[model samples]
Structures are given as C-alpha cells and as structure tokens.
Target: MSSTIAPRVRTLLLLFLAVTGALLAGAAPVSAHAALTASDPRQGAVVDEAPAQVSLTFSEGVAVSDGAVRVLDPKGKRVDTGAPADQGANTYAVKLHAGLPDGTFTVTYQVVSADSHPVSGAFTFSIGAPSTTSVALSDQTAGGGVVGGLYGFARYVSYGGFILLVGGATFVLACWPRGAGARSVQRLVVSGWLALTGATLAMLLLRGSYTGSGRVGDIFDLALLSQVLQTKTGAALVSRLLLLAAAALFVAVLFGAYDRRVRADGTGEQNATGTGDTSAPGAGSTDGGTGTAAGTDSTAGTDSTNSTDSTESQEKSDLAFGLAIGGFVVAAGLAATWAMAEHASTGLQAGIAMPVDVLHLLAVAVWLGGLSTLLVALFRAPSLDAPVVRRFSRLAFGSVAVLVATGIYQSWRQLGSWSAFTETTYGQLLLVKIGLVVVLVGIAWMSRRWTARLVQAPERRAAEAVRTPVGAASARTRKGAKPKAGSGGGDGKRAAQLARQRAAVASAAEKRLRDADPLRTGLRRSVLAEAGVAVVLLAVTTALTSTEPGRTEQEARAATAAAVTPQTGALSLDIPFDTGGRDGKGVARVELDPARVGGNEMHVYVDRPNGKAFDVPEIKVAFTLEAKDIGPLPVVPDHIATGHWTADGVQIPMAGSWTIAVTVRTSDIDQVTVDKNAQIG
Candidate 1:
C-alpha cells in the first residue's frame, strides 16, 4: 500500500509543480515597480544646446548605485562626467561633459527604488539637430530570466516551509498534544524547517544576479554577495537565517523534550520509547506475598502517584509556557524579515502596515499550515482525539477573523482607489486570492460541522451505554453460544469465560467506532479540500509581491500628466551662430506660437554675445523635414524692430523633426547658417 501510494503522491506533486510554474509564468515580469514620471530634456525634446546636467524624476524615492546614470553620445561613447546626485523630491541628476557635440544623446539609468525593487530605463534628446544615432541601445529596462525564475521559486518554497514549520508546530502544541510524539508530525515540522532554511540560502545567493544582470554565474560571485548584504533585502534574509538557527533549537525541544513530556504525562498511548505496555494490570505482584510486602508495595505506588501528580504537573505547565513565548518570538521575527523588506515597509502608513502585515502572515501560517497538519493527523494517527479537532477548529476560526481584518486594511493601503482593482495586476491577483479564501472558508465550515458531530459521538455512545442494561449486553454477546459440561471449580471457569467475552465485545466496539465514523471521514475530506485551495491562494500571494502595487502604479500615472500639445503651447528654439565676422557670434531666439500642423506666427529676436540687440545685413529662415526629403519651406520675416523679425502665416504642413535653418548675414562677405531641430507636433 505504501509503495502504491508513493507513486501517486509523486505524480500529484509533479502536477502541482507544473501548475505552479504556469502560474508564475503568467505573473508580471520582475521589473522595478517605480515609474519614471518626468525627466529633464523631456525624453525626445530637442534642446537648443546641451545642458550641463540631466535630471530624472520618479514616482517614488530611489537609491542611486555606482554609474546608475549614464550619458552616451551619438557615437555610443560615455559622456557623463560624474555619478548621479539625488536632488530630492524623488529626483536624481547626473553631470555631463562640457562641450557636448551636436547630435542626439542617450541617457540610461539603473537605480533601486525605495521599495528595494530595481528600476532601469533609457531616453534620448537632441543637441543641435535630430541626427541618426549610432549608439547601440541594449534593452536594460527590466531584469529577469533564469535567475529571476529561481529566485521566485525559492520565495515560493520559503513560504511553503514557513507554513509547514509554523503550522505543524502550532498544531502539535495547541491542537493535538499527543501529536508531538507522532513520527508523521515530527517529519512534517522538520521538513518545513529544512525547506525554509534551504530556500532562504538560495534567495541570498540569487539576489545579486536576480537584480543585476540576470546571470547564473553571478550567484557565486563574492563581490555580488557582499553588495547584497548591504541592502535592506539582504539584511532581512540574514536575520531570517539567524532566527532559523534559534528555530532549530526550538524544533529540537519540541520533538525531543516536548514529545517526551507529553508521552510521559500519558496524553499519548505510546511511551517515551514509542511502544505500548503489554503486561496485564497488577501482574507484577505475587499473590503469595506477605501482608507487609503487599502494604509496602501499596505505599510505594501511592507515593509515586503523588510525586507524578505534583512535580510533573508543574513541569508541564512551565515547559508549555516557555515554548509558547519562544515560538511567538521566533515566528514574529521570521514574519518581520518579510514585512520589513517587502511592500509593507515602504508604502503609505507603513508604520501601521508593517505590524499588521506581520500579523497577516502569522495568521496565514496558522490557519493554512494547521489545516495541513490536521489532515495528516486525521489520516495517520491511530486514534485521533475529537478534542484535538475541536481545538484546531477554534484556532482556525480565530485565524480567519484576523486574516479578514488585516486583509481589508492591506488591500486599501495597496490599492488606494476602486478603479485600480480592475486596472492593476496587483489588485486582480488580490481579488483572486480573496475568492480562494472564501472558498476555503466554506470548506472549513463543512469541516467544522463534521468536527462537531465527531466530538458528540463519544458523548452519545456513553449515554447509550448508561441506558443499556449489563445483562442485555451480556445476553447479546452470548447469542448462539453453547454451554459446556462443568468440571471442578466450574464457577471460576464461568467467570473467566464471561471476562473474555466482554473484552472481545469492547474490542469490536472500538473497531466500529473507528471504521464506521462517517463524520471523521468527512472532516478529513473537507480539510484536504481546504488545504488544496490554500496552496493556490499562496501562489497568488507570492505573485502579488512580484507585481507592482496598485497604489504606486496609480500614483505614477497621476504624476505623469498629459503631454503639452501644440494647440495649448508654443515651441521655442535658441539657434546660436558664429559668422566669423565682427560682432557676429550671437543667439537667435525664435518662437513659434501654436507650433502645430497649421498656419502660425513666428518671432525671432537676434541678440549679440552680450545679450544686446543686434542688426544684421540679412536674416533668412526656412524649415525642412529631412526624413521626408521635403524642401526648405521659406518663412519670410520682416524686421519689426531693431533686432526682432516677425513672420505671419508660417505654415508647418506636417508633424516631424523639422530642421529650422537661420541665416544671419552680418555682412555680404561674412555669413553663417545654423540649423536647429524642432519637434513640430
């Protein structure tokens, strides 16, 4: 039977892994959650001239790493002068090299958001004209692949381990004290510990690669490991590892000391050696012993009973109290490792959210983990106590209440708005988890009903036994029996036969109680169903951590206002020219009001190097769309002031990168034409 069941269990485990893989595959990519709301040079804007520095603004605060911001010239060479500096208000700026040449320049950045998620992206802006860039643009906006999958898998395993360890231990201590001596219970809790420890180590090793370049080789890099240890996430993992060491001691005490105590207290049928007593009651004494010997034995037995009743009772109470305090500390510490580093640590009302989240995690571990423990006990224990099931039912109900209350607060804090429920991935996953919880609750309700019936069975049986006559029970047992001829001492022989008949009847009744109890069977089935739904719910919860919170996404969208359209604003350009003539190095400030695909007015103010008005022999302006091979459409401007030129009805026929050429003929012999790029929208 074991061999046949082993294969079926393996197959089901494989199927579960396949389903988990598919769900994880559908999760949002492990990209940084922070959004880039705005930037200096404005993404694709054509600056009149290169600025000394470039700034990026995010929806949340971000930490800059070495070379977090890089500026690349059109030739794909680095032009950034220094590292990025945090300018506050979720803005960071990096200096650029002086005298950056005319062409489009790319700005790439990679930073860690306040929430410990890595953010990376790139943008471009033109200097003089929109020229074709030779810069090789590699996609670095998101980081995730093999390393990410492994990290994610490790996370799921850690959660599973937490549930098993916390739940199994709690079940043994709080629900079924006798289970402390059960091999199945011991193995379940130990497996949880091992799995959680291993998964934590895996996460530690994979963190660098998962967030960096998504390389497998980086997992072993000591340098990367050092870097990881310095971050919040790293600190949390290390703390968890330390707590696990303490948990190891706790597990030892639970299975070793606690189990022995429970068995010694006679809570479990088996002794400390896991063997039942086979000797008949009072068989060790000899009937031929003297009265004094018999009296001595009676006195010793009474003293032993008193010693056990006093000393053992106090010891049990002390041990249970210490275990309770130790377990709470270790469990809360483990939960803190998550709440301190994940979304709960950085979002709004984080001070309140962190403790609430820790409670939420603990409640899940207790309810889901306890359900798993109960299901295993129901199937494997020789004689599962009805009281144990009742205890767990009460515990589960409390856990569910805590889950509901904490879940509502967390949902509101993470989502913020109603529309986000449908618009955001985090909210959708949350909705799925809630639905699973509801289904699980319904299953638990059914299990509770069965538990109630199971608990009442013994009472009902005892009542029936009291109402039935002993003579009737004996007559029923003796039905179809034959009376043998009496030998010497026939009365004694008859008494022995009656005793044997009663023992057989009691044994049969116990068997019937076990095999014929439909309520116990139904409870097991319902608990199993609850555990199954819980596993899926856990998967969804894991996915939610990877996905961006809806509140952050909404905030990002809110920060990123609508772009300025031509109808609402105007385009201005400062074209610099050096005619290589006397007093010819100056700037021409040109403005196109409502620079759209229609007729517009143009104004140009030519200033000398000292910012004073300047008169030129001739000033000519025209626009050309180089991508479309369009000719220079002339915009004839008449000199309206000493240094100002105005042109009415300057029609920009289409929207594109239109090169505006300005010719300032300081003299007939010395003139220069400068081209400035403008995005006409």
Candidate 2:
C-alpha cells in the first residue's frame, strides 16, 4: 500500500497541474462590445434656450428593444420626451414637443447592448435656470455583481464548485469499474463536474463581452433572466440539467451503500483452518472481520464493534459516488436530447454539435479518468502480482478502445471533412490529441503483454499480479475455528465440504505460483506514459473548443442571407400635393425619390415600385431642422404640411450626422423612408 499509493497520488497531482496550465494558456478571445461614445445635450451644460430633443450614440451597433432615457425636472418629475426609436443600428432619438419651460433637466439612460447586456448612466443640465442644472438622475443600473471579491470566490467555489464536484465525480462513477480502453462511469462523472464548474467560472468572467456588464447578478437580471425563462430552448435545457443532477444524487446514495456492502463478498470470508478447508465460498463468513462471533457472540455484538456514525459515513461516500455517476451519464444523455428538439438545427449538418459535444465530453472523462486509474495501478498497488496486472490491463484496454472510437466519431461529425482536421483550429487540436492517445495506449499494451508472459515462467508469480485483491480461500483459512459444530449436515456433508475446500486451496496455491511480482516496475512505466499523453490531450481539447468552427462556412451562410435580403430602387412612392390647414402645413407626397445619407444615396419611393404608376400629381415640401449640442440652438423654419421634401437637421454639432427620413403615405401607397443626410456646418 505504501509503495503503490504514494506514487499514484503524485502522478495524479502532476497530471492535474499539467491539464490546468494547458487549458488556461489555450483559452481564446471572442469578446468585444458596445461602449458609450457620446450624448446630445452633453452632461452639465447650461443654456439660455430649450433644445427640442435628446439622443445617445454608442461605439457599436445597439438595439433600443430594452433601451429608455428619462429626463427629470429638478423636482424629480419625469418630463416626457417622445418615444425613442432606432434611427439607425447604433443611434436612438426622441423629440420634445414645444419649448421646454426653463429649469434644470436630468437625463438618465439605460440601454441594452448588442449581446443583450445592459449599460446605464445619467447627467444633469439646465435650461434657462440654475434649478434645472441641479437635478439628480437615478444612476442605479439593472444588473448586480455577485458582491465582494471574497463573496465572488465563495460564490464560484461553493456554487460552481459544487456543480463540478457532483457532476464530475458522478460522471466518473458511470464510467467506472474499469476495463482496457474503457473508463468507469465515475471518471466521466468527475470530469463533467469539474469541466462544468470551470466553464461556469469562465462564463462569468467572459460574459461581460457578450452581456456588456461584468456583473454576475446582472446575468440574472429581469431582462436577461426573462430571455432564459421565456425561450423554449433555454428554459428546457437549464431545467433538465438541474433535474438530471438532482436525480443522480438521489440514486447514488442507494447504489453506493449496495456496492460497498457487496464489494467484500468475494474476499471477506474465512474457512476453519487445520481442517484444510478449500471450499471456494470459504467456511467462515466475512462477518467475522467485524471480530464479533456470528453464533456465540451475537447478542450485543452489533452494538460494540463500530459506532453508527462511522458506518453511516462510509455508506454515504458510496452513495455520493453513485449519484455523481448517475448525474454524469444523464448530463451526457440530456446534451444529446437537445439535438432532436424543434429549436435545434435540422439540416444535414444540423443538431450534430449538441450530440457530438456530449459524446466528446464523455470521452474526455473516460480517457482522463482512466489515466488516473492507470497511474494508481502502476505506482500504488500493494502487490505486483499476475492477476492484478491482468485486471488492470483489461480495464486499460477497454478505456483506450472507447476513447479512440468516440473520438473518431466526434471528429467526423464536428470536422465535416478530413481536410477540416488540418484546416480548422478545432480540428487540428483533435488530431494532436489522437496522436497522444495512441502513444499512451501503445506503452500500456507493451507492458501488459510483458507481465502476462512472466507470470507463466516464474512459478510462485506473485509479483506478476501487481496489487491483486486478496483471494477468497486465503481469507477463509485465516479464520481459525469452525463456526458450526455439526454445520447443517452429517459426516457425509462434512466430508464433501472438506473435499471441496481442499480443492479450492490447491487451486489458489497453483494460481499464486504462476503469478509474478514487482509488477509495479513495469506498471510505473505505463502510468508515466499515460500521464504524459493525458497532458497533451488535455491541451488539445481545450484549444479545440476555444476556436470558432469553419469561418468560410459561416461567411457563405451570410452571403446567402444577403442574396435574399431586400434591395434598394425596387420600390417607388407618391403622396398628395396639398398643404393642409394651420397655415399651409400638411402632407406632401412624391413619386420615386433617393434620399442621400452621408453621401450614400438611399432609394426611397412613395411606398410604391420605383417605376410604378402613382396617385396625386404634384407635391409641396416643408423643412424644419433641430440642432443639438455645440450651441444655444434655434429651430430652423419650415413651410407647409409637407412629408415629401426632406428636412435637414444639419444645424446639430458634435461630429455626427443627422437624419430626417421622408415618410410618404397616401390613401393608397405604403409608407417608405427617404432618409436625407444632414451635416452641420
């Protein structure tokens, strides 16, 4: 135990360190987001006259779906600015009706970033009075951080750690009871748990780019939380993952107890010695290990041996191991279930990633976990005997086989073609991993065959076995006295039992004679080999996941979408020529029109085809301009009710373009936008 246990522990630690370092180093960058660029009616400015509108600009494209701005009076009463609309992808604006009654106004804005994250801020300024400049706007944003740094650590370790502890550990259980090239259920369970926990940490930190706020609580905000809950795909996924985790723990408790209790069945019994008993089942029951006599000391025997707590504790570990395994497999299964859902991609290449990823994760568990077991066997086993070596060989073989098979399948699906294996970052990393696995497997196979042959040649080959579990017959003879007097039957029964016991004894000795020793020396070689190989694979897998798949393919998809998108100049428009009452201010319409935007011409029609026949003959036009920032702005004049002629707000300053879109809607034609570019000189 001393010789084998210590080395294996060392191997595990080293391997773990290697994998950790590799993954961290290989992580990629898909992070960038909307930044506040500028605002109209700049913060903390005083003016003699009232401006008609307020607007905000961002560094990148932004959507106003979750965006709003409040202008409050010094008394904190909200002054209504017209509804904000998406003038362009990154711009939002609202108009104020008449002149503002001169006082301070505070403008506060909360906008949703493109990735759906939120940003909020506020500022105050005056219009004609000092009171207007003193208005305080609410600055609290929607998102919440998980609190202090210590709290964040606790949150991640306690919350995120528990997920991996349960998931990875349970997954290991499902992959356990190892065989050659096969991982025990436990290996996968543990890996899944750890990976998930790690991923959660990464998501929290990385989510800022996607969400626009570097806050944990913000990810769970009203808007963000709603998206998760309301989306059919999102809610179902999260709920199922949680349920699977819970159910695994539930089942693990029971399985763990059962496995632990039943585990000693083959080795815990003893036969009465000196009678030369050789029965395979043995004569005395393993219950004797409790040191309480089964027949003679039965009355209070159960109470004295061990306290209830110790027994319960052992049973609980078994339960935990069991549940972790359950959860792990279920996670893998649930991941696959997503592929068949309606929301999943359904094309030939559709739904492949979801299922393939689950399988790939399962393989990672088996390969990595199996490597741990190998290291244990080589460096930690108490005996280097033949049977133990053989047992390990079988387990190792099964693990490797499964690893290779699953890996190939995953590559086929994920890579799309053999060329992708070299072309894409993800595919190339996978190839490297496969290469490492081959090396590890080769080393193990060589050692396995070498030990098996030595067992046959060296009589009394205990060393060949390499940490074999104690045999049943040996355990029984260690029990001195026979538990029974008559023992169920007469002399005939006794003789027959004695005869069987003798045979069992003889067989155990013969087998032991053929087993080899110091199997650790050979196993150590394999364990080190596996450890090294496992390191490389870990890095490869991490790098693979960090990169985007097929950039060219994504581009092709975009190109196709563009082909179907609406093109300009396909539509024409027209509107009525009259200047309605209120002193010649009304709707004026025009046929085919192209509104220039920043020198780029925008095709506009009266909501009709560019070449189509239109209604009303002539169109009257009026224009009004509103200048923002850069001055005590005055409203420009306009004539007649005219929707036909474009209004240029070129009077606005602050290094940006202003847009006035011509909306032409007659009793007949559809509404269209003829957006004219306005540059303030």
Candidate 3:
C-alpha cells in the first residue's frame, strides 16, 4: 500500500509544480494595486512653457513619502522646489523651480498605496521642445526583483501553513476525537504550528526590504526595520506572531493533556466493565441469610459506576468546549491579519469586504486542510471509524457553502463589471480558480457517496446478524458450551459463554470491514484527487493577491483618456542635422499650427551651429504613417527667407505616429536625410 500511495502522491506533486510554473510564466508582470492613471503636462508632451507644478492622479488613495515625487531637468539634476502636496481626489502635486530650461524632464515617484503596497514609476515631459535628456528612468516597482520574489514565496508558505495548522486542529477536535492520541495526527498538527511560526518570522524580516528597496541586503537594515515596525503591515505580522505563541500552548494541551485524557477515559471505561462483570457473579451466588448484605454491595457498586461515568462525561464536555473556543479565536485572528493588510482593505465597500474576506479565507482553510488530515488518517490508521469520515463530509459541505457566498461578494466588489471577467488579469485568474474548484467539488461529492456506504456497513452487518438461523446458534452452543462449577441450572456460565461468542463475532466483522472495505479505498482516491486540484487553486489565489484588480485597471484607463489630441496652438519640434561636410551642421525648427487629422500650415527654419540663419543648397520634407503603412506624402515648401521655408494645406489623414523625414544638402556631394517621429492628433 505504501509503495502504491507513494507513487500517486509523487505524481500529484509533479503535476502541481508543472501547472504552477506554466501559470507564473504566462502571467503578466506583477504590479502594485494603485495605478498611475494621469499626470499634468501629459507624458511626452512638448509644452510652450513649464507649468507651476506637476500633478499626478492614481486609481486609489496613496500616502506620499518625503521626496516621493522628484522632477529632474535635462541635466539629471533635481528641479522640483518643494515637497509633494496632496490635492485630494487621489491627486498629488509637486512644485517645480521657476524658469525651468526648455528641454525634456523626468518625473519619478514612489508612494505607498492605501493597502500598504509600494507603487513606483517614471514619466517624461518636455518644456518647450524635446531634447537629449540624461535622467535615467527608474525600474523600481512594488513586487519586482529578487526581494519581491522571496516575499511572494514567503506569502505562499504562510498561507499553506495557515491551512495545515487550522485544519489539523479542527479535525482532531471536531471530526475525530480519538485521533488526538494517534501519532500521525499529533505530528500533522504540530508540523503545521511550526511552519506557521517560521513563516511569520520570515515575513517580518523581509517586509522592510519588500516595501523599501528591492535589495536583499536591506532586509537586515536596522533603520528600515524600525520604520517597518511603525506601519500597519508590521503590526499585523507582530500580532500574528503573538497569536502563534498562544496557538503553541493550545497544541501542547491538545496532544499532551487532551490525548492523555482521551486514552485514560477509554481505559477507565474498560476497567469499569471488568469490575462490574466480576461483582455480578458474587452478588448472584450469595445465600438467602446474607441477601441484605449482597443487596447493599450491589447498590454500592451501581452508585460507584454512575459516579465515574458522570465525572468522565463532564471532563469530556469541558475539554471539547475549551478546544473549540481556542481554535476559533486563533484561526480567526490569523485570518484577520491578511484581511486588514491586503486588497480587501482598500477596494470598494472595504468596510464590509474585510469581514467577508476573513470568512472566505477561513472556509478555504477548513475544507482544503481538513481533506489532507482525513487522507492521512484513512491511509495510516489501523481502523478508522466511519463516523469520522461522515463528520468531515458535513464540515466540508458547509465550508463550500460559505465559500460560495463570500466568493460572489468579493468577485463583484473587485470586478465591478462582467466584461472585466475576460478582459483583466485578475478576473482571468479568478475564472481559472473557479474551474479548478468545480472539479474539486465534483470529486468531493464522489467521496461523500463512498463515505455514506462505509457508514452503512455496520448497520448492514447487524441486520445480517439478526437474520441468522436458530440452528446456527444451537450449533455454536453445542460446539464449545460448558457449564461452570456453580450448579443452579448453570444459567450464569452459559450467559457468559454467549457474551464471549458475540464479542468474537463483532471483532471479526470489524476486521473484515477494515481489511476488505472497497468504499474506504474509493474514498481515499477521490480525496487525493481533490487535494491535487486544490493545490493548484491555492497557487492561483496567491497570484491574485499580487495582481491589480480589474476595476482599478478600468478606472485608470478612463482617467488617462487618449494618448494624443488635436493641438490648440502651433506645435514646435527642434530637429538637429549634420551633413558630414564643412559648416554643414544646423538645427531645423519645424512648426505645425493646429496639428490634427486635417490640413495644417507648416514652417521650417534652418539655423547655423552659432544660432545664425544659414542658406542650404536644397531641402526636402515628407510625412509617413508607419503604423498604417501610408507613406511619403511629399510637402513642397517654397523658400520665403534665408534658411526658412513655408507651406500650406499639408494634410494628415489620421491620428497616429507619423515620421517626418527631412533631407538637407549643404553642397552637391554633402547631403543627409534625418527622420523624426511626431504624434498627429
């Protein structure tokens, strides 16, 4: 059995790894929750003059750090005059220095989202005309680089540990009380506790680096760690550690005190039965003269038996009640840590979303974790009672119901529209998870049916026992029946022999049920399959937490609007040229009045290296829309001034990136052609 089961478990694990790898490889780059939707001056726009301040808008609220918004000039030097200020409505503005140079500038920002994830990005906007810039673009973003990968892995570990810890304990307390004494169950629950504790500590140590610098070395930085502890995420992780300490005590009681109590209770019951059996014959064999004394002894024995039973019953009730309460508090507390610091705390209807998220997490842990515990018990326990499997079935069914209710609410809150289901990464991943869960549910249903059959086996056997012929009983009595020494019809000894015969038959029936039960075997296979799919589902869920929600993506798109629009005034572009000849280098200033999808006026000026007007032998200009493959629309401009040319009715057919090719000839043999891209809108 171990050989067969080992191969199956290995296969399932391999499949899980392959599927997770594929999903991660195909998944879009992980980004922070809050998205930069729009910015003042517009990205890559060339304005006639610089604005007083640079403003930015995001899809959600954010907290700005000191120097969070930095504006750099063409020389890569900071140009922003003051710190960033909040302008409400999820907008922030940073004042720029007065009289800024006429060149491209880079704006880099780093802010914390409301949900405590860091968001960072950079954009470029020109003052008068786009020119060479030395400002390097920032590549830092939330959940990117080596630190992010480690943090993400830690998150997965934490979730896995949470399931094992909660599910194992709940199984021992609610599904199978006797399992507490079993070594397998004891190890399962204890390992869960250890995993959760270690993962929590790892998260705390990595949080500072994850949110600040993407450097692995920064994880040990005392300053960063101090700052992290002051934040909400830090507080939550600390709270989890404290709760885990409490959980450790609970585990000790469960496997130590609780296991001993269950074992002692079983032993005491057996001893009580043996004592009653031995006392019964003595009371019956007494003479009539001592009838009163025998009656008193029997009464005393009856009272003692009742007293022991009552005490045992009360102890069992008290222990069960205490475990239930302790388990719930610890599980709920651990779940709350995630709810208060993740996507649920920032989105729409967050007040209601947080609690719903907690319930959703709890339900997932119970069902998936419980399935693992049941699988181990079924395979290892010598004689697992059918009642334990039945109890877990009911538990799983209830958990699924809760999952459905809370899942729908969460989906609606995050998506906000049906189209998002197919259009966004978060929604697409959600669909995949839903599909896996459906398969898991089907497998669970099959397992439930098998459990029902297993539970009915005892009843069927009892019915068969009742239907046995009277001749069979007579045969058994004739084969091994012997009257005891006491001669009064030998009724007591014969009754004892019949009781022993019944016990032997029951033991044989139980043995047959354990060794030859097809239902148990079927249930184990179904549960194993369920667990395999559930592992994949959990991976998808972890990915979803890092993905940007569909509603936020949609809102960001709407806020940014079109990338280009018709210019209200003449747009100017400075294009530099060198013909590789003596005194051939010059700058061309091209102007398009009202650059849009229609006819527009244009002007071109050629200036020498010393900023003086210079005359060229010949000049030519044409426009091409490379995206649409429309090309080489020639513009014949007549020379109106030295180093100047003008044209009218230069038609632009559409809105897109258009290449303006310029040809200049300083001499017959010295000529060059240069192309510049311009947005025609």
Q: 269-380 in candidate 2: lDDT tens per residue?
A: 2222222233223324454465334433433333333344346546646655655566566645544433333212222344454565555455554445555554543443
Best by lDDT: 3
Can you tell me which runs of candidate 1 are displaced by over 4 Å? 1-22, 28-31, 139-141, 267-296, 459-516, 561-681
lDDT over C-alpha atoms for residue 598 of model 3: 55
Give the candidate number with the greatest TM-score. Answer: 1
Pairs that collide, model 3: 566-681
Score residue 167 of candidate 3 by CA lDDT.
89
Candidates' C-alpha lDDT: 0.78, 0.45, 0.79
Clashes in predicted model 1 = 0
TM-score of each: 0.73, 0.45, 0.72
Give the alpha carbon lDDT tens digit for every residue of 542-566 in model 3: 7787778887766555434432344
Error of 3 at 428 (Å): 1.4
Which candidate, 1 or 2, has the higher lDDT?
1
Mind giving the per-residue lDDT tens digits that candidate 1 earns over 191-223? 889989999999999988777777899999999
* Least accurate 10 contiguous residues by lDDT in model 2: 592-601
In model 3, where do residues sit more than 4 Å from their true spots? 1-28, 81-83, 138-141, 278-299, 459-515, 562-681
